[model samples]
Target: MHLNYLANIGRYIPEVILVLLMVGLIILEATYKEDEKNRKYIFIATLVGLVATLGALIANMSGKAEAIFSNSIIIDQFSTLIKMVMVLGTLAAIYLSRFSKDIYESLKTEFAIMAVGILIGGFLLASANNMLTFYLGIETLSILSYVMAALKKNDQRSSEAGLKYALYGGISAGLMLFGMSHIFGVLGTIQFAGVAKMIPTLTSAQLAILMPSFVLLFAGIGYKIASVPFHMWSPDVYEGSPTPVTTFFAIVPKLAGIAALIRITAVFFVVDSPMKIGWIGLLIVISALTMTVGNVTAIGQKSVKRMLAYSSISHAGIMLAGIVVINDVGIRSVVFYGITYLFMTLVAFYITSIVQDKYGNDHFDRFSGLIYRYPFMAVMMAVVMFSLTGLPPLAGFVAKYNIISSLINSKNYALAIVLGLNSVVSAYYYLKIVRLMTLKPQESNEEIEGFGFLNQMVIVSMTVPVFVLGIFWETIMNLAAGAKLFIQ
Candidate 1:
């Protein structure tokens, strides 16, 4: 028993380091005064911890799959990859917040602590194998997100974003728990492995109970991924939250949420299972609706932040189509898409944050004459826009290609076509910003601030990946293919 315990500890070293970092940050915050010097130290400390966590994750990826703590969680390649993605997203967010004009400087330690909390929750969600652990992870992420959304305390919109998020999150959580109860009642087990074991034996009546239970559980996942019906709060929250927090919201939570959903879906709805057809059909419909709503609505949005918020919904729908495939190819596409998305989305938000810093608003008009003012910055933004529009030789194009191909391979042609059309629809809005940046003259020749050397390095780092990955995507595709779930 002691040996097993030690082994589990060794297996989860990365997660352990993350938890320790969280505690360490809290202690540092408590001891240090709220001042610039201390905030800088806290930021540095956070970055060091994040880098250490990443190292630990890479070191531990060679181990064989195994469930720890009575199958509450399973440490494997799937969890390792997703956890790394979450950490990377958090790192970007922390740095961005350190430089952001909107987030209060005094709250640096608190922000780092909360971000670490979300990171830990993401780690938990990625490895969860039982209903109890799943709910714990989801709530950990959701609750911290509410606080993060309200981090801009003086802003009324931020407060409203937090409140709206809390209300929506509460409803989603309640429904998820209710669904878990029904599932446990029907199958007499809470572990995903147990669900699989009992699925074939289920009667028609039990399947009936299961279907609604699944839908209810999906509501919680849907809310996290921000699908069409459950996506109402995202635009408001994304617009109101500090830019760094908004970027975090756009990237990390969606990845964790989808990772958890993929785990659940793989366990319960295998290719040959009777349950497969029902969930796939539902997913297809959701995918189509989410894509259409997200792209169509983004075209009319005046706020750049809100428009990106809608764009995130469209991305979610595309990834959801991959989920419906219920195969290794689908999982690979999702993972690859996830990696590409991390870069493009961060760059987009980074640019938005810089523009907001300069003009005091994130309107498209703020970016007028960007090319003439800052040629490098303008070109980088253009690359981001084109990639998002899924034009060739950019990572977003490759990501979208894999997704659509996965859909076609699964015979989900209609959804694949919807995804393709949505890409075309999406180009109008993405390019609209490009047009404003290049064609429209600025209202004045006033100089813009921000985009310092460090910020430029950050932007270039993210931008280069979007371009490089488009040319050489095999490495990421292989990594994604290798990170398949243990169950499948």
Candidate 2:
């Protein structure tokens, strides 16, 4: 038992570090006075911890798979890749928080603590091999998300956002737990591998119970990914939350949710399962609607942040299309797209926060003549927007191409068409942001100030990868190819 416990600890070093970091942050936050200096320390500590966690995760990665903690957690290249995404996302978010006007001194330590808490949840979700751990991971992430949304205590919009998120999250959680009960009733096991083993033996009556269970479970997962019909809370929450929190929402939870979804789908919807076709059909419809709604609605939004909220929904749909293929290649594409999206979305939100800080709003008009005032930032924003639009020679284009190609390979023609049309439709709005920055004339003589040195460094660090990876697609693609969740 002693050897077993040590083995688990050795295998879970990254998670151990995260646990220590979260506990330390909480203690520090409690012990320290509310002041800017302490807040700065909190921020710096959070960044350093996240960076260390990332290093630990990379160090722990392996081509082989292992089940740790009595098989509640699975460590492999796939989970490692997903955790990397989460750590990187959190790091970007922590750095970005330094610039938020809404996150004052009093909130800073709590903000770092909550972000670390969410990162812990993210790491768990990525490695979860049992249903109980999965649910716990999600609940930890979701509860923190609600509090983060409402951090702007004085703002009515922020309060409303938190309330909406809580209500929606509650319904989703209930559905998931109920579904778990049904699944447990039928299969007598909550471990994914156990469930997968029993799938072939399920009677018709058992399958009827199981199919609904999967759908119910997807309701919770769908809510996390912000898929259609489950995405209504995201835009409002994104618009109302502190900018840094909004960035965290856009990246971290999405990565964890998608990782969990990929695991669930790979386990339950393998080729020989009787319910595979039914689940695929349902995902198809959901994916189509999600992309359509996200793109079409974004066109009407004047606020860039709100529009990106919708855009995120669309991107979720596109990523979902990769899962529909249900092959290792398909999973690889999803992982690659996810990595690309982390950089793209973070840089986009970083710019939005800067714009909001300078102009007091994130509206289209506020972005006018940004080229004349801050040429470097304008170009960077342009790269982000163009990349988001899936324009050629950009990473977004590569990601879209990979997803679409995977769908085509799987003969999901209808979803491929929807994805294509939505991509084209999305260009209009993305370019609208670009056009507002470049073609429109300045409405005032005051120069739009650029971000401070550290902020610029952070944004550039994320931005350069989007451009470099776009040109050198094979590197990430090769890395993603090894990130398959299941082996034949």
Model number with the top TM-score: 1
Q: How accurate is candidate 2 locally (lDDT)?
A: 0.86
Q: lDDT tens digits, residues 1-488, model 1?
A: 43476757888888888899999888878777556454666787899999999999988787778888878889888778888888999999988888788888787677889999999998899899999999999999999999999998988999999999999999999998999999999889999998888876777888899989988889999999999889999999999998889999998889999999889888877636556677777898998999899999999999899999999999999889888888788887888788888999999999899889878899888889888987888899999999999999999999999988988886878888899999999999999999999999976777666788778888988999999989988886776566554544
Per-candidate TM vs. native?
0.97, 0.96
C-alpha lDDT score of every prediction, in listed order: 0.88, 0.86
Count backbone overlaps in model 2.
Answer: 0
lDDT, candidate 1, at 480: 52
Clashing pairs in 1: none
Superposition error at 86 for model 2 (Å): 1.0
Best by lDDT: 1
